[model samples]
Target: MTREVSRTRLNMLRSYAAHDHRDNFQKAEMV
Candidate 1:
């Protein structure tokens, strides 16, 4: 159960990281 929770949290973190990276790319492109 703990492992499953950790996995879910890790996935959420990865998604946020990806979103931030994409945002950064977009800002760079805009500039």
Candidate 2:
């Protein structure tokens, strides 16, 4: 159970990081 929770958390973090990276790239392009 603990391992599954941690895995979900890691996936969330990875997705968040990807989203952030895309936002930064778009902002840079706009500039």
Candidate 3:
């Protein structure tokens, strides 16, 4: 059970990081 929870948390973090990267890239392009 703990392993499953950790796996999901990692996946969520990875997705969030990718999203943040894209957002920053867009802002840089606008400048």
Candidate 4:
């Protein structure tokens, strides 16, 4: 159970990182 929770948290962090990266790319393009 703990492992599953950790896996889910890791996935969420990865998705958040990906989203931030996409936002940064958009900002760079706009500039």
Question: What's model 4's TM-score?
Answer: 0.95
Off by over 4 Å in 2: none
- Candidate 3's error at 9, in angstroms? 0.1
**Candidate 1 lDDT tens digits, 1-31:** 9999999999999999999999999999999
lDDT of 2 by residue, 1-31 (tens): 9999999999999999999999999999999
lDDT agreement with native, every candidate: 1.00, 1.00, 1.00, 1.00
> Could you give candidate 3's per-residue lDDT for residues 1-31 as a string of tens digits?
9999999999999999999999999999999
C-alpha RMSD values across all candidates: 0.4, 0.3, 0.3, 0.3
Question: Global lDDT for candidate 1?
Answer: 1.00
Q: Would you estimate the TM-scores of all the predictions? A: 0.93, 0.95, 0.94, 0.95
Name the Cα RMSD for model 1.
Answer: 0.4
Off by over 4 Å in 1: none
Clashes of each: 0, 0, 0, 0
Better of 1 and 4 by TM-score: 4
Ten-residue region with minimum lDDT total, candidate 4: 1-10
User: Model 1, residue 17: displacement in angstroms?
Assistant: 0.2
Looking at candidate 2, what is the lDDT of residue 1? 100
- The residue-level lDDT of candidate 4 at 15 comes to 100
Candidate 3 stretches greater than 4 Å from native? none
